[model samples]
Target chain A: MKMKLRNFIILIIAVTFVSGGLFAQKKLTGLEIMKKVYNRPSPKEMEAKLTMTLISSSGSKRVRTIKQFIKDFGKVEKKIMFFLAPADVRNTSFMNWSYDDPNKDDDQWIYLPALKKVKRISSDSKGDYFMGSDFTYDDLGDRNPEEDNHKILRMEKVNGLDCYVIESTPKDEDYMYSKTITWVVKDRWYGVKKDFYDEDGEYLKTLTLKKAENIKGYWIIVTVEMFNKQKNHKTIMHLSDIKIDTGIPSRMFTERMMKRGL
Target chain B: MKKRFFTLIISLILIIWFGFADGLQITGYVRNYDGVLLNDDMDFSIVQNTLDLNFSMQTSKVGFKVNPYIYQYSDKTTVFDVREAYLDLFFNSFDLRIGKQQIIWGKADGVFITDIISPKDLTEFLLRDFEEIRMGVTAVKFDYYIGDNTFELVWVPVFSATKFPEQGSIWAVTPQFPIQPQFDFSRKDIKPSIKNSEIFAKYSVFSSAIDFEIMGGYTWDADPVIHTLKQIDPFTHQLLSLTAIPEHHRLTVAGGSFSTTLGPVVIRGEGAYYWGKYFQSEDPMLKEGVVEKDYLNYLLGADFTIKGIKFSTQFIQQYILDYDNFIVNNEVNNLMTFLARKDLLSGDTLHLELFSYFGLTDEDGLIRPKISYDITDGVNILLGANIFFGDKGMFGRFNKNDMVYVKIKYSF
Candidate 1:
């Protein structure tokens, strides 16, 4: 009995040391984690080639390719996308200027190759799906941390990485999604998975990060998939040939460049 | 041995052509379009097969594009059209384009308020696509860019007039003239000369607050006016055969357009004022039976989205200043347009759209409803209907032309 008790005490001590000293994690609020994600560092300039594949519920597939350029000017972030594949949309170009000021809405423009016209479009379509994809325009953009009320639901694991499971409710009651649950990877400063709920509080869609890479000391998302639970449709995006800090010219984001395809 | 030699020659030519074509980008579409009259036992009104092709090559400082289209009718008659063929030259702060090109302007939908750069083709009475209805002009266009602003100037060395329907065609309006009218062709054509050239200039600016454009043009009217010379018997007060003379006149115009967004709604406005305009007069007291006056055309529009559906509405007006009772055109003409679109089904492959134009002045309008389905990557099928309603106005004239159409298209 004495030997067994002594052995049990030593084992208990070892476990206590392991849990308290070696593997301890700093407790943080959900808002803090989301703030970290919102303030994550990004490249001043980036160029990427992306291929998007959309799959229907009946297992039909459609693919499109794009050559995209991005630049950050402290106060504004400008992006230009040129369609490079699919004959119908080939040479079609789109431009967007997203301002850092929360009060200022984004500006978008599209150039139709057939008409040779550049038209300004409303930016209020953030909640609308993009190019028939499961991902909404808001899903592809940045959201301020203050726009949501976040609470840490639990600590979990996602994609084999430790994550902070957080539930975020939008400040605007009439927003597209009633709430979104995100699995934020610990210390990586990025969300690996998210779940969206409709207004009735039923699950609507889910987004999962499939792959990522550490490029030039920067974490970059390589592939992602968005699945609509209600519609049984999904879209996958694979990003390739990512060049960071390439000093992209500001002139590349103009209406003239939208009409002049590369 | 001769056959072998010819095959080898053909293979060598193809190899050379493909080698040169590596730098060229080719895109085109093949479409089958059918239109049926609803009331004529669903009889086929028109059937057309189309092959539209576009080829382009671009470099850092130079580029060019060639667009050609062919339309074949049910009668085995084919019409070949060169839509646009242009060469582009790029500079540090400016670009120049020379050739047959189409320039689009303004923000109005289905209405031409300030978008008068290119003449239109009324052969089909606006039933054709806008791209097909607009005729390209051979001109030199220069665009200078400064930050978010652009200054454009276009010079047309040769005159290009609107394509009107031929006589005795189904689209022609049969008139009940007092006497059999004889036509004179002496002034029917505007000869190509520097003196007869047209010039247009525009300045556009894009800002966070709004997008706006200011423009001015000096050109000939695309439509001709008929000047009737009265003829009567000396002894008997009886009318004689009338000779109609159609002539184009100089027109001076100034216009501007603006677009802005307020929260979830977008607002657009466009207007143009003409200094010289000729109106047909039916009053016997007026000399020449025509009056020259100033004209105004304007449009106001708004677009919004609700429940994933996009909605757009517009109000347009055309005013003839100092209007006389004998003028054929109404002093104040009002028009309204509405468009709505939605996407449905998995991956949004199914689409629905409704567009309508309300001629408030004439109480005539056209309503178009369409359904589109994307079967595959580059294949699309569309089914649509055009309903015209009115008593005796523009659309009323086509009350019998209510049609149902289907279009199948393949792009590659």
Candidate 2:
């Protein structure tokens, strides 16, 4: 009876060590790591104050303040933003609805405080920069993984942390970006830095994440910087007073809420 | 005394606004605008200074906003106006706003087809900014929001008429008639009463691929109708003078607008059918020298961006049903507007834009080309020119007022 018990204990230890070694030695493909990054757990709602600063190579700076809210339903995600500073643009608001269906187009609208008019805008102007910022409208949205071909290039250390270097090339030849290379953190499942190339295969821009924190059980990036190589301009986004899962009412995403701002 | 009293009231409001310790927001701008006519004389066309202020406060259940401005012309005369002062009450699924406010509706740009709730200020011949062109009205507005849909109702208990340029002003446009007319101003004013009030309603929906709104209004005509009375000499039976009596009339209007996108292009449309609108006629047999006709006004526009340049074009038409030669206006009036803009330089500190209006029916046009640079945060420098062409039409009548202007604005 004693011999049988010892053998059973030895078998159990062998299985655990073998499994742990297998998991540690396993290599993940670029697509799988990217999928994990895209599908990371997110809060159902978010509210925050955003400050966008645009800096030119000549050392000139322009700053804008905004109050933003975002909510995610099952099939659609809605976001609303109101300009809170720069007296000229005060009370101006914007709303967008993104659909999960690949065939559906997003809906967008902008309210001009000066004209007191709400204007519906097209989503296809993704290549155009937003409000003269270095970041294009496309950069502000999520890209579907199916549209790109991803390959794991190499593993490297970025900012004293181990990262997976992956390059994704768009399937469509006419896409604004030729290819994008990203440095995703080893286990945290988020991109720390990304490099973009233009259609001409020349370096166009870089987006660097400056800060990230665990808020309400979700890892959220609070600050990021996008630099345009062609214009030598950069836009830094800083988030403050962020609250998540605050039970933001679904009605808050409507135009009425935009006009009747907080 | 009136100007001083106005200033004193504004000062008091400012002082009271500053007393609040929390959540009281105050902002505005100070601007200097100067213009020079392009004629050989090169005389000054306009010299004005403006101070605009906005005060707002908000709590969880209620909020309020007050906007007042002052304009000082070159003659050292001052004019004070309150653009909007409103109180808001918020609820779970709805909201209520009361007091003087500006309400805008429609999908058209630079046109007022379904946007008729606020009377227009034509004092500057439509060259002023749209915010300055639309005069606010005292009203109660209710907005109920559903999932992706909204219902809005507006009630105005008083009447406000369009403001036209005074006689002898540079923007005053005198219609050239067969004979000089003596205007009878007896019935031109619309008395403020419940019977003369206006009501408007709209239903709007925003979806994954399209946005649209349908609206209807029971209101007074934005502009007055002229009834001509021919004066004749007794002996020769010859026409001596024409007397025009301008009067306001009630009308019903229904309109809707929609906007959609196809790839990179945005298409927009707006239309309104006005019922029982009076028009001028030359028929001497008619007692009032006018006819009642229903008209339709619509606008279609498209906007696209390519290679960092944005382009927009709109086609507008006014069609009077039951065409007649006696009517002064053509059976169909056409107008087109075009705009192209480019933002250049690092951080888009420089901007260039060209906008123009072409009157197809009259072959007249007006073009404005402007360039602006951001000198620093909250400060801007702008230089532009307004050029008009053609002999006579809506826009051509102001050809002599073509001018170059400079505006420097600093906001806080």
Candidate 3:
């Protein structure tokens, strides 16, 4: 009995040491990974071209190839314009004049053909639907790490990939969403799933990342789905046939281009 | 024959314009309402049924609109106004329009979330099939861009009905006694033939941190008094001569709206002051001689939208500017005396004020919980029920005077 108790105590100590070693190993927090991955592209220095395909449940489909250019001055004013569409939407585009400062808000505009106007929609109204889509203008805006208050919850496996669970709360009260819970992969900082809560702290929407692929050394999202809980509406954006680093001009982001019938 | 000619023209225009569109968008709603008679205590019954049709082009290049309506009352069924016949032209930065349209001006609960000016009060005014502003007018609106912000300027010239009660209007006999000192008013002699005319301007700066908008405008009126008014003339030495005179009635309004972000909540606020030349008799000696000046109406409000639900609170005060010009009657005297007597016992002064509010959609949202309270008399309250549809759209309300109102509204 004494020998058995001694062996049991020895085994327990060994297991504790191994567990401690594993726990103490270097692991990146969610915020750190997000910051690193979000800054991976430069529209000015490095160029990337990509295509997205959106397949609807009713057997409808849409495709787009977006060519993005990043010019980093003191503040980052990234220009993301559309490159290809099935229709004659060659010059049709959107521009994001974003500032790196957390205190300052970003300026965004879309060239809408229906109104035949380039509307400068207020950033505070960014949470509204974009042309009846689930993605708000804010959702499509360039991600800035400093605008949100984030906390790393835990390390978990999502879609068979190791990911860090993160919770973020917007500092602005006018924001339509109260809090967002994101599941991001540790290696590439790609978000897998996100649960959005409204201002009243009620679960209002969900965004799911379906497929991810590596295209020309750039990680790209192949499929994405967004659902509005209260409105019973869903929008899916698909991206495929993506090629990065084809020369796009800075003049494409001008109002003259938007007025040229897309 | 005139009405039929107008209808035929409108129909032809709509059909011809719709035929040229590639994709058509049809959007409208039908409403049904049942209401109980308040005067006779009749049981709840069918009050109205309404149908509305809106057809537009997908491209929104060009379109025509028509809204026709009919209403059935207890004693009679009536075909009300068929308004909103207009041509919409969209240019690069300007929108030009002409027709019998709804031109909603003023920042007093308009355009942002509700139509406060065009149709007046939602529950009481719109619910009733009263004469809306059906004028043959033209408008040109320009939205200019400066960086990330936009500057909007709109000019509308309308020839419509009376804006306020004068010699021949319904509000001529009304009296003003406020619950607060901040709201005050004054009046002057005016002719009743003047129509409503004004130019509205708005400069708005929209941003995430601060959204600021300023609006101001003016209106005119001059007409004969419809209701009975105590009259006196200084030059003629006329004692209590009942007559009407052309008085210049003008109004000026200015206001601003601000919205800011505080942590996890969005705070929106707006306030405005309206100055006009309308007044009441302040002194018993000069009650019929001179009109008091400085009629004032101001409002302050705030609303918070958290999650999907919205909560709002607003306070409005209206008072007499020159108390000496107030013409008090037996009813007003009794009410005041009773209130003073009650205040002596309760240690609280009775003040006349009207408080109202809504939930969900300020007034433009889906569901409106609207209420009006008279703080002067035991806080008498009036509430509007759900709205139904018909040639005359229908809605019912229970008022403080034990009066029940069932109204039908129709607009083309």
Candidate 4:
């Protein structure tokens, strides 16, 4: 009878420890969750071809084709984009170098075939649209979690997938958006959808990851769509021919390469 | 004529060769320009059409490019020209190019300070696009890379002179004299020889936030100095015959340029010190002799964009060392330029631009305002006007040449 009582106490202790551990995991703060989302494992080098389709409210459409290459250098990230289609913009290329330090602005350059020259450009405003697309320059780059304040609003299901709804407000009042609400999948840790509000607390744009795929242990967004509510315009981006960890050389990110359209 | 035929045959052979290659690309544009002189009582008109073809082929170790242009005028005249034709051989860390090419230097806009390698076509002055005005020269170029720095060397065996407007063209400059001297006028230009070959070298470093380059070159001035040789009649003290010889004098240029971003603005500066530069003297006694002087030219420019509008401004100055009293001009000349561009429409299909340059020393200026619209994927239409101000100097002398023009271009 004494042995039976001891077994009962042991059972009680095991149940309590297991339940407490699960509860602790669920109690993770919004900041900690966002840090995980921001620091997700990414490929050191990647190359991709993107097709952007711009749709107007009147049903007019324009298409652009771009080839992109990216490389991470620990605290610094370098990217180069080359326009491949639309005869008018063919051979035009853009290069950018982003630093991890918040005080340092990205360095950008553009090469115009007509001029046969590489022009250094200003990267002061991240809110400017990129290449006539619905996505701003900031949206195309990774944003540091420390730049904003995040709060876990609740737990909900997005597209039938369990998600943690988090709201982030920019620390700078002069930022382009007032706040953003994101729905991140619990298991995948992928941001499936996000809604941006203007300074007046009005819905400005909605960004949705239409499709994602798991390739070689990496989860990558294959298709994305952004809709601008104020302008009633939309941009759909389709990424294809993606290559990860290809070991691209650092020399390929130079101005000479930009001019060569390689 | 034989050279022309040979070039045509070679271009055809290359086209055929690259046509079957795996990575060959062919692109071009067709453009038409209709212009009318607004200040000339609408009597002067210009109608021209051009078709340009660009061919390129690239492999792992070699590349080739060629650009040919065909121009047609309203006077039933047609001309064929080759803009650039080059063959590139790539190495592990260096590349060599041979043939006719256009090389650009410096960071200033609408100004020439350190950009002196390629000759220019002054048929329409600054009204023409900069790319259109640049004329390629046959040369061999080599570029070697070291880390983020590059060393470039260029050699041009033949010298090319800048092309001026035709004698009867609206943009022509007729030399004015204080007296109506009755004499025969003749002009001659010096041709290039082995001793007059041009050479240039530059070292450039591009870093994360800044890029800078230092260059030096030995070449003949693109613009020739006119030397007057007059023969006067001994009996009437009248001029009998005059010969104007245009000579390309040797010049040495050493300069450097740097560009960096400061906050939201891009700041760029370029300066060059020219040795043995020829300047025109207004004094009658020295008119027949071109004065030689060493001068320093510099430019500072900045560009920024705000709310989808881009604004750029530049200040340029030229200082002549050891100023001569007989030069009859300021030792320092100043010029400024401002450019603005804005896009309209949701897709940025419509653009408006204004570019203006002012001569602070001479009180002369030029303002060009243009609007462009993309009708389709590869089709564009542009309308613009060139207006001039001042009563003297470069821009003022062309006051009567104010014009309004329309351009339509189709690319494929």
lDDT of each: 0.82, 0.83, 0.45, 0.81
Query: What is every candidate's C-alpha DockQ against the true complex, given to 2 decimals?
Result: 0.50, 0.49, 0.05, 0.49
Q: Write the per-residue lDDT of candidate 1 for residues B246-317, one digit (tens) a residue.
A: 778889999999888888788999999998898878887765567899999999999989888999999999
Candidate 3 on A1-262: residue-level lDDT in tens? 0011001001001111222244346765556655654544422333345444433334443444565444433454545455444322333566555665665655555554322334443345455454335666566654556557888988899768887888988877866789889887665555778899988999987888766555444445556777767655566665434444454444444553444322
The runs of at least 3 residues in candidate 2 whose Cα sits more than 4 Å from the true structure, single-residue gaps closed, are A1-24, B1-20
lDDT of 2 by residue, B1-412 (tens): 9999999999998886666547888888999999999999998888989998988888878888899999899964688999999999988778899999999999888888999999999987888878889999999999888887989999999878899988878898776578889989998888888888999999999876678999999999989888888878999988899888989889899999998888768999999999998988888788878899999999999988878788999999999999789988788989999999998877677889999999999888899999999888778889999999878778887879899999999988
Clashing pairs in 2: none
Q: Candidates sorted by lDDT, descending order?
A: 2, 1, 4, 3
Q: lDDT, candidate 3, residue A127? A: 53
Q: What is the DockQ score, from 0 to 1, of model 3?
A: 0.05
Off by over 4 Å in 4: A1-24, B1-19, B179-188, B231-242, B282-287, B328-330
Error of 1 at A65 (Å): 1.8
Clashes of each: 0, 0, 72, 0
Docking class of 2: medium
Global fold similarity of model 4 (TM-score): 0.91
Better of 2 and 4 by lDDT: 2
**Superposing all C-alpha atoms, what RMSD in Å does each candidate have to the true structure?**
8.5, 8.1, 15.8, 8.6
State in Å the error of residue A227, model 4: 1.1
TM-score, cand. 3 vs. native: 0.52
Q: Return the lDDT, model 3, position B324.
A: 53
Each model's TM-score?
0.93, 0.92, 0.52, 0.91
Cα error of candidate 4 at position B275, Å: 0.5
